[model samples]
Target: MNPASHGLKITEQDGVSRIDFVERNILDEANIQQIGESIGAVVDASPRPRLLICFENVEHLSSAALGALITVNTKVKARDGQLRLSNIRPQILEVFRITRLDRLFVIHGTAEEAMDTFG
Candidate 1:
């Protein structure tokens, strides 16, 4: 048997957590859990408002990923924080629309846009 795990790199900046996926997204449970934990860690570390930026590494996203994000977004909102996304591909945009998460979360056109919004 063979196994593959998606790549991800997370950094902190300006009171926000920047998550960059180093590999293509498969939306696997491992990745989803990590994503959730990352958000939880940030919130637990400080329940203050935060902006989470995803680099949109994959053209297609998995349902698990989206669900995890929705959960994280709800958590952020509960803590008076915001979850923002960037670098979304056109096809993924369609998925967001299909799921209506596009309306729920802030999807930025680029990392600069996300940063500029706060500034």
Candidate 2:
């Protein structure tokens, strides 16, 4: 299933699945829920189940969004799948660091680097 939000772009290639955040901030609860549902659908549908979420365009993230990510991460892990994050802005990256989520996810400087690690 495709993401309901146009702000998210989902793509799959060579057994690697990527979800790119096209928007700058994920602040609203509705958007957060939509994104979470979209990610959940992707996790459920992916065959190889290697998911990369690119935060290249995201400058801000809300608590709800962070919670959604954690939920998706758990779902991915439950399926024995790999979930990664890439291109996180420094300020936004600090949230992960503060929340200790940085230790939970495999983060990379670029989407290509994250995809490479899936190999």
Candidate 3:
């Protein structure tokens, strides 16, 4: 699928799907919903999905965006899939830490590092 049409850039390699956000700020409710759906579709397409979401472009995100991510995580787990988050900026990482979501997710400093863990 062309995830870029829905504000995401996607690439797949070695049975893993990597998603990068096209937007710098993921604060809009509508956009967040679309993102959730886009990622959800990717998850659904795989029997045992391996997804890496790179936050290289994102500078800010709302609480609703966090909720959407949590939802995506839940869906991944339900399918016995793996989800990794990478390239998160310090400020955004701080927010994840404050929310204790840092523990809920497996985060990495770079997409390459995250991809290495997919094995």
Per-candidate TM equals 0.83, 0.92, 0.95
Top-TM-score structure, candidate number: 3
What residue pairs clash in candidate 1, if any at all? none
User: Which lDDT value does model 1 have at 82?
Assistant: 68
Which 10-residue window in model 1 sums to the lowest lDDT? 1-10
Better of 1 and 2 by lDDT: 2
lDDT of each: 0.72, 0.86, 0.93
Q: Per-residue lDDT for 28-68 in model 3, tens only?
A: 99989999998999999999999999999999999999999
Worst 10 residues of 3 by lDDT: 1-10
In candidate 1, how many Å is residue 24 off? 1.0
Q: Give the TM-score (vs. native) of candidate 3.
A: 0.95
Task: Please give the ranking of all candidate structures by TM-score, highest first, separated by commas.
Answer: 3, 2, 1
Candidate 1 vs candidate 2: which has greater TM-score?
Answer: 2
Query: In candidate 2, which residue pairs get closer than 3 Å at backbone N, Cα or C atoms, i.e. clash?
Result: none
Once fitted onto the true fold, the runs of candidate 2 whose alpha carbons sit more than 4 angstroms away are 1-6
> Relative to the unseen true structure, what is the Cα RMSD of model 3?
1.5
